[model samples]
Target: MSATEQPVHDHSTAALDHGRRGSLGQIVSWCLWDFGSNAYNTVILSFVFSVYVTTAAAPDEQTGQQVFANMQTVAGIIVALLAPVIGVWADRVRRRRLMLSVSTLLVVASVSMCWFVLPYETHHGLKYLYLGAGLIALANMMQQVAEIFYNSMLVDISTPSNVGRISGAAWGLGYLGGVITLAATLALFVLDGGFLGVPEQDAMNYRAIAVFCAGWLLVMSVPVMIWGPPAPPAKGDARTLNVVSAYAQVFRHLRRKFRTSPQVLGFLVASAVYRDGLSAVFAFAGVIAATSYGMDTTEIIIFGLAANFAAALGAWVFGLVDDRVGPRFVILASLATMVVFGGLILAISATAMFWIGGLGISSLVGPVQSASRTLLTRVIEPGEENEMFGLYNTVGRAASWIAPGLIGIFTALLGTRLGLLGIVLTLLGGLILFWFVRIEGVTHNRSRVTSAA
Candidate 1:
């Protein structure tokens, strides 16, 4: 193979069928992990706990929001600094499954600790609020790191031809899982003081939900751990490198990629910008719904359900299209659609308008995310998957602050409605930059090879 070409390694062998479709059991087992992860994504971060942290935990709404933002920024910085090193370590150790398991356990612990974050009106409320935010930060950092190891396992479970579908299936399953868990929490806890009779005092209902989420995550994670394929054997001695030296190796790897695989570099930069925009869209969706459209907590939960359902459907449907038309097309189309819908949300203030635009924008988010991963998997050099995925996480975290920062600035200067302008602009920026990226040829070649084989 040329320097630019990927080599098939023994790591590819763990899956029952290498260079072909994985077994249904393996695929389902792998996808189940994504399903279980929604406990964190949907309940803890996106819908319930974060909202509580802002509305109940802090001394006031603005202070709480600022504190939350600050903690996320801190988490992003840490992830950016450490993702590459962790990726290098995972690649060297060749134990992505074990690393993922350990990282996931850490996340579960952080999430469960959310129970201790009490309301500001309670004794030591402010102190606990800060503590809660710290735990969230820790959870976010660990979650992002876990994703690097998780994503690297994609190659072991799929072939070049079906990668798009498998990726979409995972993302779709995650959204679906989020919806179910969020609904369960709503039915069992958040609604009518919860059927479980958990006291509403001190927001214990919410705390109980956090514990439930941890257990849900732990349960769902079991299938993958039990049945998912193991990492392929390492090529040589297994010597762990320190963080500083790992970073040095990362720089050298980057240089090599720039020369031999510019597509990977280009996609990384473009995806970073767009992915940040996508995250910002969801991150601020609740706030915008509550403040601008006058949505209450229940209304926000209903809206979240709708958005997650739409995203799940979109991911599954577009995944098949991705394999045929190429991931590049799917990404470009999704980005363009999101940009337009985001503008629609900014333009109209009616609740109906928010629903329409919000769901439209959300529907495309999963497709964009799934396709981006598929595209990267198509182009990356084999055996270096973990490291490259780490860079993916690094670049993403490096730019994570853009949308939030822009939204804050715009909201301060213009108005709450105009804050969405920041998200739209970020998406537009990514769309424009990604337009110049040339990965169609890579996908085309891979398809041909797969077909011939």
Candidate 2:
């Protein structure tokens, strides 16, 4: 066997003897990490705390928006520059568990900082907001890195035939986790008073939500660390280096890797454009609804729950399509839907119209996006999956600045309504570019060999 080839064993017989040890259980545990982690993104970062920082926490809404955008932009820059390097390190060390553990701790610590956010009256509130944002950005970087490794583990657990199912199941479970967390948070603070006589101040409730999310993340990650086996270390020089040297080596490696296959580079470029647009849909959706359509925090939370539920359903349904059809077709279809319905959202102004148009378009977003991910999985070589996903993360982070920057720019120039028009245009452009990606025959031989085995 070549150095890159994983040992082929008739584990199918062993699995049958031991009641068919399916990847489903491990996949579920892996997904639970996303579920727990995204609680921060949905409840704290995107929805509740973002509103708090912008509306109440900042000097004003304009300043809040600038600060928020700036923080994200800076983080994206750092992640874009560092991701490929760290991805190479991950591949060399095969130490995904260690990386995951370190990153999770950082997330927990950063989230716990929410407890220190004073009420809006104090000057320290703004300082706390900036500090928290910085930490959150750092934590998010770590989370992204860990996800590169975690996603790579999918190859270890499932066959090519079941990869889509496994990926879809993980994504669905994560969304379900988000739905539950959001619901619990809303019930605890918004709908009812805080647990056991706690006050119902927005800041206080948000703090509790952060703490809950942190605890949830730490706890849920335990199972995967315990049960999922580690990959063997790469058989090359594995010495660690300072960040500067690390980055230099990564750049050198990236040049070499890209030269080896231009298709990989093309995939990254196309994925970056569309993925950024997709992320923007989640990041700014609440803000658009709240500022433009007068939706309250509670309403935003409800919408988020609805969106997550739809996303979960989409992932499951699309998983089958991914296996039977192809990931590229799924992505093209989703992007087209986004362009059409997204335009309707840009045209509408009233809150009722917003909800009607938004939800109508949102229904198609989840399934197509999930299938796009499965498509990436289909293209990469197994041993290189982690590094490629790391590149995926890098491209995503690099492109992250575009949509948010566009949103900020357009909102300032044209108004929130027209800002959405810019977003729709971005999605349409991404769809057009994504369609040109040739995926039908790229990995057919490798897939055939695996299936035949």
| Residue-level lDDT tens digits of model 2 in 119-178 | 555554578657656666766766776777777676666655666677777777777887
Task: TM-score for candidate 1, please give it.
Answer: 0.94
Question: Model 2, 217: alpha-carbon shift in Å?
Answer: 1.2
In order, what lDDT does every prediction score?
0.84, 0.69
Say what the RMSD of model 1 is. 3.5
lDDT of 2: 0.69
lDDT of 1 by residue, 1-453 (tens): 799776432211222234645578888988888898978988888888998898788888888878887888888888899999999888888888888898989999999999988888876447877888888889888988888878887877888668889999999999999999999999999899888989999899999998999998888888777777777777786789898889998999999877656766887898999999999877889889888888899999999999999999999999999888877788888888888887777777677888998999999999999999877776666567788899999988888877888998999999997899889988988888888876534534545544554
Q: Identify the runs in model 1 with alpha carbons over 4 angstroms from their true place.
A: 1-21, 443-453
Give the winner by TM-score: 1
Clashing pairs in 2: none
Find the candidate with the highest lDDT and give its number: 1
Model 2 ranges with Cα > 4 A deviation: 1-24, 122-125, 241-249, 256-260, 440-453
* Clash total of candidate 2: 0
TM-score of each: 0.94, 0.87
